[model samples]
Target: MPFYSCFAHSLIQNGYHYSRKSPWTASQNIAAVESLGICHSFVLHCIISSFPGLPLVNPIPTKSLEGKSLIIRVFIEQFYENLEEATIGRWLKAEGDRVGDQEPLVEIITDKITFELPAPGSGVVRSIISREKSVVPVGCVIGLLGEPDDPLPDVSAENRATLERRQREVESQALIPSPETVAPEASVSERVRDRGKVRATPAARRVARENGMDLAEVAASIGGGLIQEEDVQRWIERRGSST
Candidate 1:
């Protein structure tokens, strides 16, 4: 027979034997047996069934910028290339300050050309994102100023394309040689000729000329040959004593 049928037959035989010796009513005995069977089924299910795995949940907090009045976004100079020591002149706005639209935020000077960068809108200067003397690329944010609840202005694809074009133009200008390049124009021949004509003390000259040595050679030996009177005297004394 099937396992369940065999088990039920055994339970019926035990119940009949127990009923003959017990004084309980038929309904009460049957109810008690059914309750025991239910308990056994629950235990069996608990042992045989595998539990389902649950995934973990994480909560993240949101950032809020609510009540600020103004934010200034300082952009890099469109025409400026390298930021030399003299590029930054002065700051027109301070931290935690209020400013008007088109007001000067900073003065920048490059190669004798000075520019006053204007504020984009009227609002309090919330923060200075870039420090003084820092070199920032064109279109990079240097500061942010705006009302607290105002959403950040998006740099759209078109605006980004324009900024990139302007940046390329500025970079092309920077690639051009500056006037400082003219300072190194003196040729090697000019330097050698200048060195050959350098004046020396009489004694040094006598020693060099007598030894059939070039003054340039002597100067090259004695660290650029700025021959002092003492050097000349020493050379003369050494020459006389050597003979």
Candidate 2:
């Protein structure tokens, strides 16, 4: 079934009298003619976002324009040539929060690296369609942006087709990464060992031994996490020039 049909049915089942077609007046709002305490614009936005690449169509008529929208669609650049999918790592900004242009709102992790999704334009995050840890394709609608009072846009058929066409073009240019391009990873034990290793100058080691102090202890006491001759001297000095 079409997304609008399914959503309309749900609303109607819940006692909402959705208009059969676009109509004018608040009582004839698209989704909730008799609904109360519900932001009709937000509901419409949610429904339209559920259907990717589909225009945000408001069959209902309104007195004014649809309103300004600042959409931040997922766009894979040429640098992401071989990546087909990524997992949502985290959301730095929540829905309804104001965001500055180019500010990172969400973190997405691919096989190679974790990157932040920057805001396309300064606006509020009206909706977060993509949830954390959900892996999705490259060109899907991950989230929505809009002004404080901006009503949901009526996505035209032509705009929907254009978005899909662009997505296809991006996929056509995708390439597979060379095996050598993959970086070597360190195992847990290796990482622990690397962290446990103490770096100290030869003079620092001698000073530590002469003062009955271990380099490990010196490293633990110092803020740098690395032991040095001056660190040992400072430790000795702090200890009244003795062990």
The best candidate in terms of lDDT: 2
TM-score of each: 0.34, 0.37
Question: What does candidate 1's lDDT look like per residue over 9-92, in tens digits?
Answer: 554444322222333332222222332333212223222122111111111123212232123345554464554233455779
Residue pairs in collision within model 1? 68-148, 69-147, 70-145, 70-146, 70-147, 71-144, 71-145, 71-146, 72-144, 72-145
lDDT measured at residue 73 in model 1 versus the true structure, 0 to 100:
45
Model 2 residue 40 CA deviation (Å) reads 24
Instruction: Give per-residue lDDT, candidate 1, residue 207.
Output: 67
lDDT of 2 by residue, 1-243 (tens): 575576556555544444435333321232232122233233453344344333222333332233323343333322268767778889999989988756888898889888897765456887777689987665455676666675644334423554687687877756555554544232322332453577788899899888897565566565334577999998888878554
- Spell out the clash pairs found in candidate 2: 22-59, 55-155, 56-154, 56-155
Alpha carbon lDDT of each predicted model:
0.50, 0.57
Residue 71's lDDT within candidate 2 is: 45
Give the per-residue Cα lDDT of candidate 1 at 88.
50
Best by TM-score: 2
TM-score (C-alpha) between model 2 and the true structure: 0.37
Model 2 weakest lDDT span, ten residues long: 26-35
Worst 10 residues of 1 by lDDT: 51-60
